[model samples]
Target: MFKRNIFICLFLALVISCGGDGKEMISLHPMQEKMAYADHETIMLELNEVSGLNHHMPKSLLIIHQYLNNETTSGFITNDLSVLTTDKVQISTINDSSILILEPSNNRLIQYDIEINSYEIISDQGRGPGDLYFAEELSTFNDKAFVGMQGFQLSIFDCSMDLCVYEKTINTDFNNYSIDATEDQIYVLGISPFGNPQDSDPLNSDHNLFHILNYQGDVLNSFHPAYDDRSPLVRNRLSSGGMIKTYSNKSLILIAFDFFPYLYEYEAGGDLTNIFQIDNFVQPIYESKESLHSGFSAGLIYGNKTVIDLTTRVDDEWLFLRLYERRNIGFDHVNVTFTGDEWYTYLAYNVERRELYKLGDDIKTTPGDSRVLHVLDQGIMVNNDGKLKYITR
Candidate 1:
């Protein structure tokens, strides 16, 4: 039997939405790091640049859902995986070996074997010691699976065994938005527990957005990522925090903030390696403190209102970033639509060339709901409906 309430409580414990109680807009300070590049090399993104990413992606990479059997799903939610929410589905691509999916909705972990063209449920859902409670992320190290729990717990299971058992549970006082592990330690990225009455104000708190802990959950190190300190109001909102993902094969972790159009890269052991930024991205202009506290009403007022959110995807050679730009598309408050009023911009950075290129809408419009599920060497994997789709290069 499964404890469904475990996931519900875990979800409520974590899932910190990105929003601001402050009325001011955070200032834009794109990456200002200095490094060497080839002669006449362009690193900064131009406002009118044409990325042309689709020119490279194969129109139809390979849809895996069609290969999967959905005719019978008695023990599952539905036979169709295509309808699952991509954002809620956590993916760990194993190149051509296999792909791992952690579906929190039903609390099940599925393994899609690439060569065999079949999938299996590997991890069972439960709130008990060995069971998975709100498994938001999964990564492998030395053939073992590390499951990131939303409820401030990190569980390591013996993946080499046919039936994985809980090896240990690492406890923390903070909620984990995302987690990754190396041979030596476990790393997580998330926000301070600001909503907790016991937690201090973010601006006054000493904790950083990133944390490094050993297998025993001992805090080895932490880093205070740069913040948009233009004003206290904006800084507080920026403090709501963001997510970080690791490219273990590349020994890199990509970080994206909830407030801006930039990406920060760090080496596995907590070192700032690179700062990538897109300068032309839209930034909200806050004229005064009155505008800073505007809240939802601000999105309604007349003016060129701009809002930005960042999401990132990566492969060995490239780091892909998606920016959702929303604006007030009406002449006035009359006949205005808020939820569906938005456009997307995709930017990819070549690791070898260190250049930023905009991707085409066809390729940019990935099959998934939010970020690409996985970035493989030859293609990208996305969850279309609930089916797995791979867009080949």
Candidate 2:
């Protein structure tokens, strides 16, 4: 069953790419030379420009949460030092004074008003219209909130008023993992539909990877990372799903794969501009497997200490990445001892300086503790006592 699932995922990537509209696709390739690791250096990031981001540069600090072991938790500290905490919740800056939190566990969309020091559950939990179900991803565009939920559904809410009013829902054709929006478009990172796992030939197109949509859920365009031609590992849908963020003002879309140690930057119009890598680490080691019962070729992995958790954030002058790896974890049905403190590394690249820096190396931190999760606009978001807090310079 384990190997079969891996085969199914790879097979799905091929099928979905081939089953889409027969438009010509754009292929991406990484630079030949990888960025070398430099000495420990810290660059301070400031949230200065706040028009598209909807929040002014806070004088104090704000932080996000981290994914520890197998859990993701975080807290949001308002500019006034008010704290709103939840488990597995994603927060988006609705405005300078308000924020939207997507609490997936309770299926609640909460609007927290920092000025009043209060929060209200704006949307209820259900399968009905305007309800939030297992919603994880959240982004704001044009005074609206885009909530990506389970069952391949996206809920859009109007936040122009005092209360967010649900507008409509978008039913996507793929399994969306993360999302971001520009001033006019929504970028969804998802895997194509699982057509027939037994299908042998992979059509290999960009539409199988990304889906660009308008506010009305109309697919304006579809494209994948420009590296599919260089790396075959990206053909597996499971490994390709990662974090995607759009710098609206910059007109840039940054993509970081969970398993691949590389960052891709593209123009909003689907042009690959730059590729980034920390140190000389390119890819993970994998052993092939074959199923005897079903005669399925499972070739992704067997045992490897690969990147299981990844985060990417790009500021004006620097790009930040946090990579976590686990050991002795086999893809097959073998159990291994739970070894805490598997390896955590933090790296940053300065675009202007054209240098790479390593901030942390194999830090001895446990889960639900002080593990770094994300690189924020102005500070680093770390997990403290199971709650996410920001550490400013």
Q: Across residues 25-138, which tens digit of lDDT does each residue of candidate 2 receive? A: 222222121111112132232223112322422211122212222222344342322444453456666665576767667778888665576778889789999998767577
Give the candidate number with the greatest TM-score. 2
TM-score: model 1 vs. ground truth: 0.61
Top lDDT model: 2
lDDT measured at residue 244 in model 1 versus the true structure, 0 to 100? 70
Over all chains combined, what TM-score does candidate 2 have?
0.62
Off by over 4 Å in 2: 1-88, 104-106, 134-136, 195-207, 225-240, 280-282, 285-292, 295-320, 325-340, 343-364, 367-393
Error of 2 at 265 (Å): 1.7
**What is the C-alpha local distance difference test score of each model?**
0.52, 0.54
In model 2, the clashing pairs are 28-226, 28-227, 29-226
Residue 231 CA error for candidate 2 (Å)? 15
Instruction: Give lDDT for model 1.
Output: 0.52
